[model samples]
Target: MTTRHLVDPELVALLDLIPATAPSAENLGQIRAMSPRPPVNLAQSSTLSVSERFIPGPAGAPDVRVLFYRPISAQGPLPALLWIHGGGYIMGSADAEDSLVTSMVSAIGCAAVSVDYRLAPETPYPGPVEDCYAALKWLSTHGDELGIDSKRIAVGGSSAGGGLAAALALLARDRGEVSLLFQLLMAPMIDDRTSTLAEPHPYTGEFIWTRQANRFGWTSLLGQEPGGPDVSPYAAAARAENLEGLPATFINVGSIDLFVDEDVEYARRLMRAGVPVELHVYPGAYHGFRMVASAQVTETSARDQLAALKRAFDRSV
Candidate 1:
């Protein structure tokens, strides 16, 4: 267990700027409305292009909004990434991830598509995951028109988005609908059991995302309760009994983040199940530490992610 004093000095400085109040599940709408939307300027902004559109969603559901980012200098169909945004399953939008998505477009040299899936407490369970799956299916089938290499599509996200990416990988494998090239999970929220752990891990869950907040996020997403026997693996990825057929995976988390234990365990299980996996745990960091651009750890994390994505894209080429 770590203490606030043990966290990275840069991260510690950054955390001191924000008020340390936990969000209320019942006031998600208000909180989401108040969330900040920062503008992003890609390093190679002139060479990258972005497009937006609405695609068919799961039957009876609203159309899903997708933002596509591509390199204007590309000579041919590019490998693609279906990016999901993290919001604890109750808040966030494609707009919220615009900066990171564009950065990936420039760094990974892959066409990126951000999915605007519905949030929970309102949409719940299959609703959010299905929306993301629908967007993935649309992208795969429309690869020709989108100038993408259908077979090289990968799924990725941060926090809750990371959880969705993992779940989407499982769904695609089970349904045989879309073939994925990779899965990138950053501080992913995977185990619903996390909130119910008999003895919670100390030194973690104290900054950024907390245990009480986690319970609210999971409960909001699961509709009923989290960690239930009948919970689907597609919703709570850590609940999966078999992790054999998933794609090559890249998992990263801060040693002091609430998700560190779950993410580490999942990576171990994936390796045991004979799946290709890469795991990175940064010490003295907290959840979403990569968001601190000035911190050296943030640059390292970004470079590591780009390296993994480059390897995946190269294999596809």
Candidate 2:
């Protein structure tokens, strides 16, 4: 018998609001060019700090940007999350994820430092990873002003952002530099090995993040052809040889996504290393299926992710 996800009814409205295939470079550039740069706006339920900045990137690149989100009307140190926005390391900007970041502040009631890492095919391998690591290091070093609880900090993101967060965890561990409390990896694209795309994905295969797009994202970021020898663990978190001593993690993926198998495998490795791992897989949902306007799957995915993040925050507190 097939199983059904406990989907939320409101997801339809949210998904319906997204434009199909609108996250591309041309579309994103057009939107940014036409619209005025909005402040870090919050929902009615949230109390958010404003005056966000796009400081010089940690990677020392000119255009590498980072946005800091602090909870307003709150006091003292709060558990923080290093939030990364997903656009296949190609097109997304910090503003593309303000709503989600705002919602994260509301749900977790914690300060979130959202890093706008450099994209691929330009910055390439180690670029985004290094930039994000720099942001994490900066946050930890300035925990007092940022109101962050250094011991309770976590890392999280969606899609490629999720992959980066996972990679960040490993990088922090390998470098023995910083500590991470938890990892929230929602539908991450971690594997560069294209051996698992046996069936055509129900979404984003021919739409937004096609197999070709995945190839480009992986190859461009790695700075060498993907599926080759000497792939960096920082470039593809899935390539990490050991997951021991890593922080606890939560991963959610769609069964119809090309990344499902690799995500599941990554979780397995995390568990194998005695790191606590919680995984959720929704059938019939494809890559970025949650972005499909008005889909039941999207709402369920969002609510589940919210619950997972809130739970993670609750655990640390």
Best by TM-score: 1
Q: Find the 10 residues in a row with the least total lDDT in model 2.
A: 1-10
Query: What value of lDDT does candidate 1 attain over all alpha carbons?
Result: 0.90
What tens-digit string does per-residue lDDT give for candidate 2 at 1-317?
11123223433343444444434334545644654546455433346774455555554566446677777777888888888878777657677778788777877678888887877767887778888888888888888877788887899988889989989999999888899999999888787775234554344343345676677667667766678768777878888898899999999987656677789999999999999998999866656766664676667777887787777778777
- Predicted model with the maximum lDDT: 1
For model 1, residues 132-245, the per-residue Cα lDDT tens digits are 999999999999998999989999999999999999999999999899999999999999999888899977998888998899999999997776788899999999999998
Root-mean-square deviation of Cα positions for candidate 1 versus the true structure, in angstroms: 2.0
**How high is each candidate's TM-score?**
0.96, 0.83
Residue 95 in candidate 2 has what lDDT? 73
What is the Cα-based TM-score of model 2? 0.83
